[model samples]
Target: MTEQPNMDAGAATGTKPLAFDRWLEHFRGNPAYHRLIEADIDWNGRSMLDEPTRQAFINSFQRFELGESGDGKRLLSKAALEGDPTYLAALELLVREEQKHSALFRRGLDHLEAPSLEAHWSDAAFTVLRRALGLRTELGLFLIVESVAMGYFTALAERAPDPVLRGIGLRIATDEQDHIRFQIDRLRQGFRNTPRAGRVLIGMAWTVIAGGAAAVLAVDHGPALRACGLSPARYWRQAMVGFRRAAHSVLANPGAEPLGPLGKGVH
Candidate 1:
């Protein structure tokens, strides 16, 4: 895949140039994963979780479900205006995949006999933040969220009592890992030509964002994390580890991090 034109960066900051074609192909080939998760997991049964854990999971995943519910219209508009066509295409698929997550979460809520929230302050905050910034800045914030999500779902996948719920968690976590890399790729390319001083400021901001986000999520999802046998302290630690891995990789001079594999059929 050819290196697409840059937004501000002269070339990709990463040693590996941007390959939006492969990214697009990767997104296109991954839809089957969601379908497999849906088919293999029986999402129609009632939760077998203990009373406290059951309600906690319902509340927590519901919030996350709402987080994934946004339609991404503004995001797509920004992508079209300033990003590579191939990236915009890949991003559209990414947004659709997030929507699929919402559907899966909705099904999970029904299975747990819980009603989904009509609104959430956390979801509203994320919407406002993304809309408040440029595409690059939005992506930076998005990367933090995705990185944190990887930790949250991984906890559940490994520790949640319900096997079906664990299945859902693992599938979502798998997708989030890819999503984090996608954002990192875009960010490295976007910021490649940024002056060292500007990079410093950006890195500082990301550090604060990463720290604050981990704390807030730990508090908000404390019950669910505890139910999954992950303490808030441990969850925060894991979240920060993932966050630093993503943030540093993006803030680095030339990312040597390899792009994840081509999806099943995209190779």
Candidate 2:
């Protein structure tokens, strides 16, 4: 068997981070990609489920919908300040895509005859955290959400008894996989020029932040997760895999090979 290299190896020994010019093109393509998905959305689809499952989804998605409803002005302003118009325009499209997610969830709630909530403590806390931080820090926190979404939505898509709900979950989860890649690419650019020691420190801090977020997500959404046949431990484990992978991209050499395409549908 091939022995794995040390997990704690620092990024200082690697070549310079890859140029982000390619991401500009990728981001440019994203708006059209999003439009294609948007066109196919079936808002009138109904979700049929048991009472317990339905309530669990309602409670969980209400909070998630609120979280997704941010205006993203701060993120846009920060992106503009980066002096990359291509990146800034792409960020605008990304924000619109996220907004569509909120709308989709809201429409799902409507289909189930469940009320969508206007606020949640978890959403409030995240908003405050993002508002108090710089772009890099905010992106780090946002990454935790994407990581959790990967696990949570995958479970929902697989196990939800309602076919419409399953379809919605699968779509959102697919988009989330790409979102993780997008965020990591930008984060790698942010840390590209930092000293090795600084990179290590940032990595350590990000691990703590990501782990905490995962723990909180499990606690906050345990009921819905359980209803979807996912344990909190399993959810946290999957989220950590995503977080660690993203952190590695930023803190170490990602290698020459592409991360490549995500699997079709839910994993």
Candidate 3:
């Protein structure tokens, strides 16, 4: 695989190059792993499914592909202002990985003869909301989406009737797990300096946001979740697990070991 052009590398700051040095190293090294995944995974496998299952996947995956296609221009600008060169580099790499996911989903859609939308109402709404807030608040909202994605993909991987869809979902789920960890780490760093009262207020606000997001996902993608043998209630519960984990990581103890898969391999 060809390397992506490096984003402008700014000078490092503070005693440590980045507060999340370990995560930065992992991000820098992930492209090789991603390339191996791209080479090894069979994106072209034909689905052997009944009409309902097939239709559900087509509906679900296309929307997900569009959501993954964002350029992250705002996120890049926000991170650039943080004065942490390593963190900015990691974020850039993160954006690239998401683009790769978008590409994978698009290819899968082409194979299935499904059309991906140029824009989704949900995507447009999310972009607008994210841009309206500062980086911290934006990340709070981002964590909510990541949480829902984690649940959705995990369900698809475990329950999709088509072997091909299951394989694709599994790969994406693996990536999402890593993404969740990265988000937690960055959120931890971002909130490290907040006072107790401030942390409390942020946590309260995030809880409300996460609840709303979970409800929206449950309603928006209920059919897809049902196809994967999950109830909307169950899916919402899984999303909450991710939400609480992120909140605990940020407000309680940023250095704590994660509650679930560290998905981030330590080199």
TM-score of each model, paired residue for residue: 0.90, 0.83, 0.85
Candidate 1 on 151-190: residue-level lDDT in tens? 7888877888887788788778777778887887788777
Top TM-score model? 1
The root-mean-square deviation over C-alpha atoms between each candidate and the true structure, in angstroms, is: 4.4, 6.5, 6.3
In model 3, the runs with Cα more than 4 Å from the true position are 1-18, 38-40, 254-267
Per-residue error for 63 in candidate 1, Å, reads: 0.6
Q: Write the per-residue lDDT of candidate 2 for residues 113-216, one digit (tens) a residue.
A: 98889778888888887887777777767876787568888887778767667767877887788777777766665665566777787778878888888898
Order the candidates by lDDT, highest first. Answer: 1, 2, 3
What TM-score does candidate 2 get on C-alpha atoms? Answer: 0.83
| Best lDDT among the predictions, by candidate number | 1
Worst 10 residues of 1 by lDDT: 1-10
Tens digit of lDDT per residue, candidate 3, span 1-267?
111122112232233322556666776777677666557556667666677766776777778788899899988897787667777787788788889888878877776778897887888888898898777667767877887667888887789666666656776777777777777766665555556777787788788888888888887778889988999999999889878876777679744443333553221
Model 2 per-residue lDDT at 61: 83
